[model samples]
Target: MFDQSRGFRDDAVETCPVEYVVRKDGKPFAFLNATPALATRTVTGFALATPEADWTFERI
Candidate 1:
């Protein structure tokens, strides 16, 4: 799955590609790619960065 979020600035946007997986026990998890697309306006100019992210869910 692909996702996008608005940056601190209205004109900036961050995008990432994710993947979901289920273990043998049926537990599910998701993670984002190492490199994500970023658009931010900095004092110097536009800059890019990579963020590490992961997600896990549990039944209540």
Candidate 2:
């Protein structure tokens, strides 16, 4: 009898860049840093809802 066999295949991929946050109202928004550009800035606070605090979170 004759032997008939198929060849094996290896498939793999690495991403050059990845997208994380989606845009909101044509503007980009993210709760956490994802991409290199997003991870560049230094963030240390969140939006607070208080009468005393001058700065608060608002949708642009």
Per-residue C-alpha lDDT of model 2 across residues 17-50, encoded as one tens digit per residue: 3444433343454544343443333121322223
lDDT for predicted candidate 2 compared with the true structure: 0.32
Best-fitting candidate, scored by lDDT: 2
Each prediction's Cα lDDT score?
A: 0.26, 0.32
lDDT at 17, model 1: 30
Per-model TM-score versus the true fold: 0.15, 0.20
Off by over 4 Å in 2: 1-17, 31-60
As a TM-score, model 1 comes out at: 0.15
Per-residue alpha-carbon lDDT of model 1 for 13-48, expressed as tens digits?
233333323122233432223212211122112112
State each candidate's clash count: 0, 0
